[model samples]
Target: MKNIYSLFGLLFISQLTFSQATLEGSIVDENNQSVLATVYLPQIEKGAVSDVNGKYLVTQIPNGNYTVIISALGYETLSFKLSFLKNETIAKHIVLKERAVEMEEVIISTPFHKLQSENVMKVERITTEQLTKNGAVNLSQGISNMAGVSTVSTGNGIGKPVIRGLSSNRVLTYTQGVRLENQQFGDEHGLGISGNGIESVEVIKGPASLLYGSDAIGGVLYLNPEGFATDNETEVDGTGSYFSNTKGFNSSIGAKTSGEKVKFLVRGSRASFSDYETGDEYRVTNTRYNEYDIKTGIRFQDKRLKSTLRYNYNRSNIGIPEEIGAQNTSKELLLPFQEIDNHILSLDNTLFLNNSSLDIKTGYLFNDRREFEESADEAALRLKLNTFTYDVKYNLPELGHFTTIVGVQGMLQDNKNFGEEILIPNAKKVDFGVFATTHLHLKDWDFQGGLRLDTRKIKTEDARNPQDEDFIPSIDKDYNSFNVALGAKYNFSETFTGRLNLASGFRAPNLAELTSNGVHEGTNRYEIGNPDLNNEQSFQTDLAFEYRSEHFEAFANGFYNTINNYIFISPTGDVIEDNRVFNYVQNGAKLFGGEIGFHLHPHPLDWLHWESSYETVIGELKEGGNLPLIPANTLNNTIRLELNDGGFLKSPYSFITLENIFAQNNASEFETTTKGYNLLSLGFGATVKWNKIEFNWGVNATNITNESFINHLSRLKADEILNPGRSINFNLGFTL
Candidate 1:
């Protein structure tokens, strides 16, 4: 600390203006134009990270010449040098090439089921390779296949993803670091995010309010946009893929063009599905659904600045049947349609300085969603919400060993409810937050931490001729919360890393939880609002161990989280004094779980691959009661045979998974016990070339036996219906 202070003091006093030139530039992917984080500086250091905007500021060089080298994972490296002048700042841009077998480094290699990944607790990751190779009608199906993650399927069409047994607003969703805006309270609001354009899915289990903002208590699912080279060096290049399954059919197309000054990328996909059948040959009715999405982006690359404009539109029709006891025979389907149109435009600029640089990034986001019911009975439960977000941040790395990422985010949101609404209020909410994160790397260990303070202010106005004499025409609710985290990882060896983490996190009550007043038919709830609810706070701890080998990588972790003032709706009737309806409130709570993952290769040849994973989670309240809908013990085992020039199979690739999701029985209140079952699946894929075009063909079978068993948390399992039986899917994709 003294040394740092002395260095700063000297720099301030010894202002001997050394006329040195600075090199400032950015490295971006050819497709999405997103910045590459991990960069190899070669001369100064082997590994350095580009700022969040894909920009890097290198300084402290004399007029003498030097070489600059930049390399990113999954892409080729480039080296260049320029003659410099005193007090001059030069901006440069580099575009990298993509490679398969001989990658610069793997950008994403971790599986979503890993338990002890890095130092982050409950963290999960899905790579682009899995997204492209696996044949799923939608992204939700693939995510639910991971250990410890389940789905609350209101039939196949409206399945909300649950991690460790929490969904809706409890777990926040993001698209490329942007928060997903949808009705987080309802079970049928799953189609708001379009999965077609996502290249990766990262699940951060447990409360992530430290990184994300409010409503991340259950965790966060981040759908990252593609930032890889889908096009070659040619003028214009593209890829197309088609897929089919017993329940649905899907197709995708993408194209990109690159030039000296600009680049453009566009992608789109459409999918439609019918009701799915269970192992007993019973069809889950009202499961039919269809959705389409389109995304386009333009990038301007220059010596001094790089900017991108992105627009995405997603629309889907979801059919849901009202749950009716053991006989789910509701012919009146509630067609809750969602047309979420989102747009974001951003610009990042860097000003080069000697020994330091200043970076500024600003972005704007607009999200809109409108809801309608196909049936009149469900019309009373409709809503429309529109939100706009503006974010900005500045980065200055002049201070060594400490880089601060501070940003201000604000949201302007308005919500409306239709129907014979009891207490429906036309309301608006403004959310503002300031957050900062710092990374400190040690010789043998690294430490990272962050803090954020967020506030939400909501204003409501209600007016109707039928209003009761005592009814109030206005409402105001303000919520504020503080978030914090601290963690560190120790590098034991070249391939082994172990980490331990402890953090305190909290999330403020959302606008809906605090201001909602109308009845909702989705959950069959005579809902009410609570204006006096407090923020939910939690304490978390994590321990992890990981290993990486030439052909094998694995991780295992155990984590614990205990919450105070846990929020939920009690079964009590409305309190009399205020004549307010019943609402969800806060109480004390506890949660704990663990996960284990591994990959082993003992074969004489390198073509054989074997992997296995397991995860379990449980929750309880302060007064001693189990939390609802938590995932049970889950297991997954997979093996693959690859035939290269000389390997295990006649084809390029073949794989199989003996997956088992066991429900030992729920011990919590209002819970039902379920029998355990094992499900086995098989898959295969091969590389084929048509003339100069190369393509991939993939096919997979799920539940080869048509297993008739429900997972521990499946809602239908509460009644005798367990799970959907056997299904098969196939996909064909081509790339240049």
Candidate 2:
């Protein structure tokens, strides 16, 4: 970590000797008339919007092969790929066809960046713009708007994502083309990465072990970072937001610059909040938190090689909430809180061959977590975790219409306890995997299949104080698995498509499950590990169908999954250290659910849109009981009004969302059922230009009724805590 900044400075200096090319183009309608449009190079994050006359100019673009996309509100998007040479100026003209619904968008998570309509497996994509419109304050909250995605949150500071009723180590999160390791095994740990600097997110809702190796039995959350700025250009942006309920504030500023062959960017942000108010106007004490984050990246590109280096550092102080207290708003936190720092550095490099490519990714992570109780000056528990990971993939030349890719991945991890309390013993873990996948493209069908083999080894060291009865004994274990996946996409008609997929996934027991022996402060329980635990394996089948046209779009998706040796915590009918004792156990489990949704736009009232969706999931242990942590069924409805070209308001929009949550009576042993509730949210946003600067602003109100309710997936539900009350938030951003 000490030398990373020096390397970035050296790379920035080396790119001063090169020159780049430029491109200019005009986008028009089918009649060859001028039409305003947005032109972008998705890979480079460069481009400009067309003026009223449909003219656009992009400079400082590296001389290489590229793809540019042009999109307009009432026209079909256009994508073009071309090659250029240094010191060259290219002129092009493009025309777009009018359409009501958008064309299929390209997905970057797959080996081949294919459009969603052409991919064998289905993937859900969300844009940063959409997340902002949804009034989400954090990464976890933003993703919860999607179907089959929920969160187990502790107040407003910490949240863990749950996908189709599975969380923790069962899900995988990837950023900067590498896996994230931030000691996520703990229930109180939140996603370390911030929502800043991310352009989009993609979710794969089923087993993806074949593509990502292990820890993907539930799903994968893939975040795409911001691309480099355009050549010879510099951009700066700032944002500020205020929350009324918590008296919270968030502020951030970012800047980026690009040269001929090099680009760099940096961003810093700070957020702080007081206790949140409940529906009854009672303040939840010690739920306040503050965070500081910094992120930077450098990119270098040549004719055949492109590389990027990114680093992020985050520090947070979160106060654990136990009960309500005085209603005064204060940012100062009390005792019984947590202090955490996470550091991530990653290097991604790609080498292009004649018809194939070689891609390599390397990453290092460092996490330090400390818990303080009774007094802020002393910590009760401290843990440090470090991980190193590497992945290498080679794309074989295309044979006829088939594309194949082979890859190998490995990771080394070490965990240590540095404080008095030890929930898990010091351990070392190693993982290695090799996989191969192929994609077949036909006139009307897409076929994909892959197979992978993985091996993991874990070794634990005895506790620091041998005489303590809570100390766990030393142990060593090895686990192995073979996984396979097959999927197909068939275009039944011009506006109809069908997809089916089957996959197998597996997860090795984590340190907390295999070696825990003491009380865990996060969960407020005495946990006992099971050294004899085996690997958890799953098989899932998914089916989906979609119909799209100019006036409307609809989709239905269903899945059923079965797992063997599913690990879960069960009460042992005993108490230790004033806490209930919970033992790690295994049982067979099955889960089934489906999601359906539709979007409609009346012919004449094109500016008005209506959308609705419903999602449900049921998980049950094979031994005649319900599974814990399953999310309750939910339905959502939205009405939106869009003004594409408001003279002064520019892209003005307003929306109202009504969410209904159904009661959850199917709960596991020791879990209580939760009542249903309804919530209404409203928001309005617009962009305006003044004094040569662009300003974007929005106002949002959530839970307008201030109804008192508990979410089944919330960790605080066990304590019968009500969710946050009505909140009015105001946000503003500026760019120049």
Candidate 3:
């Protein structure tokens, strides 16, 4: 009996061992000395940090294939594919190379998560930390720092992103892996998203319809959320910032904890700003704003599945400045202001199979927007929007050097009016898209291509009453389109690379474009929409070249885009109720632009860096005239110094930047020319450690010379309102 029991026990032990796998690795520098690093397998959401001896181990992994990423500070990140079998233990050794610049991270916006150097398409990425270091007061202002990206500003408190030369419904924004739908059709509407709890931002400068479908006809702005803490770790953090120009202050607190199988995190933030002062020391009345935001997330992971749920709530009270009148410093909103409340909830799940995986994501969003004009307690216009979206993708098993993914995405949306006035009729919208994409890799070449089909339907209810001046007839319409993208990346040498891509995109007419027959108070225009409107289709060609080495990096990117049936609203030489009349029309349009820049960190002076870049874009109708709201050319130069350590301060750094904006002479008929201007900025920061406590502090001054200027895309351009200037900003943060 004892011998039989022993045999059974041995069999059980063998089976248990065969069900799990182990991965072990050692990391070292070029000199073969131990170097601490992080080894992560994103697919399974598992990772480990190397010990002082440079040894790391991850166990209990199921049998499958994965891409492992190894990264460390001051070292070039490395990634490769690996396969593991049941009961198998894999041991690997890695040698990291020193780099003058920071290491590159995996790009999540792309279908295949790969390093920038390995992607077929060029994508611009900047971390929120970097944006903070640049002294950006808000997310919209921060993104404008990137090449080929600009913003249409109503004021410092409200701004919309304009990619290349397109805004409104053309550019798509995604947060937490889901589309952000907050009534984006209006020019005065802001992003409605807070900067708190966001990790990084990624921009795809050209059409990405093959991957993201409609609304991406112009480009995509992807916002990545902060990740949870490492396994069995808990952390708490707090941050506060102050801005002098607006007499503004913002503060946030967050906490995160992660165990072997579950993780949770939450963050709360608030901000208040008074009227902003211009370069002439004139306070712009009712430019003040206040915001409250909350973000939370939870995750569960096991051997075969990983799931995450996230939620975000935001409320904002933004004042509208018609002209400079009241100068008193007050954070409370005044008349002619907007109050917006937004809620977003999302769930993501991934199921890992033997050699493949499936990913599903779903999201729900609600937006309540109210405008107050006559009385503080009464809203002149109120609109409510609800949206539900879903996306499912299946990664097919890799075949040789080719990887493929097939996906389906769709959304259901409804809009309603709750106040006395209505900009758009009560409407319902449906969107569905199917796509397939694949990537082929070779020694020196990578080829990527995809095809997609999309369909959108819009239905509206009649809003024609005898007492109402604004009338809209009920209508139902369906729009369909097919798109494709093809791209190739070639390595010219170890340090040089080139890429070429051709893609097509399409966008269905929005509700405002098809049914509006009322006054748009925001633009002071009476608008008439066309019931018969065709979809806008675009084709673009992009070319880019990059060269990188230990001490220098340079890149040049150029693109040409042409659109058919492009929609635009133009003045009709008529007036109604003291407002100019405008009509929506379609025409062919073209835009061409490019960005070139370089970074130099000369040889032994690795801590000293010089960076310069220039960007320009030209837009015009195929027949005649220039397109509206095109940004002017810009040149940016920066000198930076990084120190290894300074007494009580660790990794102290400072930078000076000079930006020049060229005059916008190529303006539309109704647009006025904007004069060129220059701005100077300086910033410095350092980390301090005391006992077991560590904190970071920084100070930045923008428009140091107090230069007065107006951007071409500013709505206040016609009123000769200047942008804010000469602001000193201070920030402090710490982690526990």
Top of the candidates by lDDT: 3
lDDT of 1 by residue, 1-736 (tens): 2453354345433322346556777878777475674543322222345777788766544443334556654355454445556768988776765522122222221111112323334356676557555544567767886655677665555667787666777787766445667666666557455566677777776677766667777777777676523112332233344332234677777877755446677888776666666787776655566777787776664333345566677766666544432334332334554334455444444333333333334445554444445543344344566766655443333255554556566667787765444334677888888777775645677677888888888788764543654343567878788888777888899678887777776676665566555454444455555767887888778787888665567888788888888877655555444443456777798777878888775545556778899988878888877777777788889887766633322247778888776766655655676677898878788877666666767877778898887766555555565466787777677766
Candidate 3 regions with alpha-carbon error over 4 angstroms: 1-20, 60-62, 466-469
- The list of candidate 1 runs beyond 4 A from truth reads 1-123, 228-247, 323-381, 418-424, 463-474, 516-519, 573-582, 645-651, 715-722
Query: What C-alpha RMSD separates each model from the true structure?
Result: 8.3, 4.4, 5.9
Each model's TM-score, in the order given?
0.79, 0.92, 0.96
Residue-level lDDT tens digits of model 2 in 214-279:
789999999988766776889899888888889998888999999867899999989898988889
| lDDT winner between candidates 2 and 3 | 3
Ranking by TM-score: 3, 2, 1
Give the least accurate 10-residue stretch of model 3, judged by summed lDDT. Answer: 9-18
**Candidate 1 lDDT trough over 10 residues, lowest sum:** 106-115
Better of 1 and 2 by TM-score: 2
lDDT of each: 0.62, 0.85, 0.90
**Winner on TM-score (1 vs 3):** 3
Model 3 Cα lDDT, one tens digit per residue, 1-736: 2453354345333322225578998999999989989998877768899999999998767666778899997788898988887678999999999888877888889999888999999999999888888888889989998999999988878888889998889999999899999999987899999898999999998899998988999899999999999989999989999999999998999999999889999999999999989898898899899999999999998766789999999999999889789888889888899999999999998866656677889999999999999999989889999999988887777899999998888999999999988889999999999899999999999999999999999999998694676778888999999999999999999899999999999999999999989888767889989879999999999999999988999999999999999998888999989999999999999999999999999979999999999999999998799999899999999999998997999989999999999999999977899999999999999999887668989999999999989989998888999999899999999988
Off by over 4 Å in 2: 1-26, 35-70, 78-94, 102-105, 522-524
Per-residue lDDT value at 623 in model 3: 76
TM-score, candidate number 3: 0.96
**lDDT, candidate 3, at 674:** 93
Candidate 2 global Cα RMSD: 4.4
